[model samples]
Target: MSLYGKGFMIWQLARCENGNGVEVARVARAAGLSHVLIKIADGPYTYNVDRTTRVDLVPPVVQELKKNRIQAWGWHYVYGSNPVGEAQIAAQRVNELGLDGYVIDAEVEYKQPGREQAAKAFMAELRKRIPNTPVALCSYRFPVLHPQLPWKAFLDYCDYNMPQVYWQAAHNPADQLRRCVNEFKNLAPYRPIMPTGPVYSAGGWVPTESEMVEFLDAVREHNLSSVNFFAWDYGRKGLIALWNKIAAYPHPIGPQPADIPEQYFSLLNANKPAAIANLYTDDAVHITASKTVQGKEAIQTWHKNFLTNSFPNATFEITSVSGTGSTRSFTWKGVSPSRGKIENGNDTIGLIDGKIAYHYKYFKIT
Candidate 1:
């Protein structure tokens, strides 16, 4: 059974530039996404216009999206201190654009003094006109709930509260999700929660598919109505992989793999390393390993090295595997000939020819 509704973050993607209904539809269909929240702009009051001359895209991508049966939402980039004059324009645009709902991305600092009143007024007026169309509010931390903050007032006006519970550079993601569920459960009972996770960042590190799966598992565990990614590019592969997986499951949510210490690690070892190397069916990946191996030769040599060095002599037990379908991870722990006894360490492995294709290890010296 489908999740009934699936959601994704749009804007700034190469696909967005294409602006063709067919391309958009193909991606949505492939990812099992039914709803797309198009990000119109970047930060505090910076609208993503086609050239600042035309704020909306030509021919309205929303119509194309809806044609493919994808519900579309308009995200207004706003800050606490921005002028109300622009707010009216934004409200008018939402109605004209025929968007299903509005996402108020609060990128400004609201805790500072003398900022709450303006923010409240803006949200109230916007809500007053678009009463039927749901409003999704975005905020960063618990600070958005401060007495000095207008989040409460905004919440009263909006339909749902979408807290950006992204743990990219903050605390560990697992810990962060658990804490967020507890906090939201107590504070926003009436509001349906849609937590946004970090799929990508400017830091250039893209999350693997399995890490994305873990995030989705968190969303399901918390019983959130839906989950959204931060931006278009970051860890986008993982986000799409997650959507495909959810589309397969009978229930959209599942149990978090907390009790199982090696649940993630074990999958790594079970992977067909040979097949992993040839994941990109269309293009060939240029791989260079530390042991002067490339392509198929590199993959086989690495696994062989591992078996010769660690297995039999030591307990070569797989610890966890974190990543999506083809692009997965393999973590193993035991005594090795290179060192003495080991606890938790990982060797990045890839597949080739239905077996292990590539394997390399990273080290963090203490």
Candidate 2:
């Protein structure tokens, strides 16, 4: 059977509530997560030994997770400065702690001179010590963005590719996850991809509960083995509702529908008012901020005037799409010379017989 499970990565053990390992394990199990990845080390010397708790937290966390029948894996960040030292530290920790698996988090520091050789040295030393342990390479989601990082060198020695597919600054989780997996497959050897999504709210942007569900759905649609979120502390404290919703979400059972938002936006961008109107039923109604237009003819006329006269160079971009059955809601943005810029654009489309029967749009122009 496929390893279809939900998991979360913890950046630091001390960050957990009161630095309690049992509490951490209970929270994870309560969230329906089957596994947890805790940071055991950073660089060559900084072990995640909790300062406030004044104890090594990894063993207790692992022990608690094991008691709960949840897999506990350890991860370490490699700075690529002292490859042998980093590898030795990682190997020694893994051996001492006996984790279910290990993850190598290599980032910007690896994208420097002699990076490939450094990665090779690290992986060689790591494998020499723990030859049979399952290891994964976790790094930037898009290989194109970090071409200098020795992706091949590290992945060749690792067992899985755990890309940090944090959909920050954008809400299109399905599209972004799809693109991330496709890009990695094209560049590296085929490996099971267990992508990590975002839960933390930073820079005035936070993901909604619905969007998080859509991300899990996207992972299931791709037939991936597993899905994980970034950090545990932020999620438990800041996004409690979203966290509960994720735990309660049921596993998708069937194939997902074809992506229709792309086509809908395509028609809008093409300035084909008639073609766009044809996507709706003959008895369809369009609702806007200023007025409501009933019947397909009236809707067609309204679109024609806006597309041909008002916003001739308008372009629509969809950030998120969600819903089930016949109702769907999409968040978008429109740019045009006439309107200057349309932000916070939202549309709710109700379908009947595979055609739009009710459409409502709202936006703010600046």
Candidate 3:
């Protein structure tokens, strides 16, 4: 959920290297993309499923992206017709794919009368399934333009807003983008904005390479931590000029971890054992299945050996966390190259004077 830097949306799986997951991941990694939003569900049904073979096409891409250390998010386009069905499909696909984030792409359909209640129902049902997953609302760039899209109903449950600031048939990306940010800030229950810009062409008109630069500059000027493009199928392989322009732009990273638990998990993903051990006090003790280690140096060595020998090139993700004043309990999962998958990782830690004093961990890697 802590998405940062540049990302691109993938609309059609087959269009990109004939739906080869490894190829898609290689493309994303080469572009230095922090995340890739793959289409997961459309209305009440799942997307990216092979019609003839009846096999889900999303998991391969999701697996490949995660292996490359890039966040693979799922996006759904909703019509608010069958809120429950849509919500169920949303939950099913997100859980099945183990997505890093979920995006609700609600558009003009929610603007119709009597759709606000539907939005509420959809979000409530969706939350019941994946309560810990980060969700976002990707809708119109300007809420003022579409006043009846149930923005509050969706935004209340969302962790971020990614407005589609396409600015189609126009060259004023900076002006339009700035205005988009200003408007969203005033909306009720405003979430962190990670606006999406146009990388594809509409009709015969295309966004000039300079216009893309202007848009990125405007996003950086607003100090937003992240930015994304609309479509990979459209511009990434189609238009080299715009793609290169976006590549050179240094999209800023997200803020630091907010808490001790977050910092610890982040260190695990960063694969820095010494830095991770620094979070504990000098006399801290770590309890595990094999042995109990005391002191920072021992703790560091243990983690280093674990990372190197057990799960090399692995990324750990905290699935859920709960805690009190000086104690915390968290569940995590990890994935790595060479088919390493960790599903059940439960840990509890006791903090003393803002530093870890006692840590107990239980996990299985298969």
Cα RMSD for candidates in order: 18.8, 15.0, 13.1
Candidate 2 residue-wise lDDT, 53-96, digit = tens? 65787888888898998888888999999999999989888888
Q: Rate the local accuracy (lDDT) of all candidates.
A: 0.56, 0.82, 0.87
Q: Each model's TM-score?
A: 0.59, 0.67, 0.70
In lDDT terms, which candidate is top? 3
RMSD of 1: 18.8
Candidate 2 vs candidate 3: the lDDT winner is 3
Tens digit of lDDT per residue, candidate 1, span 291-313?
A: 34455545444545544553424
RMSD of 2: 15.0
Count clashing pairs, candidate 3: 0
Count clashes in each candidate, considering only residues at least 3 apart in sequence or on different chains.
Answer: 27, 0, 0
Instruction: For candidate 2, list the clashing residue pairs, or say none.
Output: none
> Measured by TM-score, how close is model 3 to the native structure?
0.70
- Tens-place lDDT digits, model 3, residues 1-366: 588889998898888767899998998888779999999999998898988998888899999999999999999999998999999999999998999999999998899999999999999999998899999999999899999889999988989999999999989999998788767755766577899998887799899988998999988776677788888888657887787888777776667335677789878888899999999999999999988999999999999988888888898866556555788887788997975889988899999988999999999889
lDDT score of residue 276 within candidate 2: 80
Instruction: Give the local distance difference test score of model 1.
Output: 0.56
In model 3, the runs with Cα more than 4 Å from the true position are: 254-366
- lDDT at residue 346 of model 2 (Cα atoms): 86
**Candidate 3, run of 10 with poorest lDDT:** 250-259
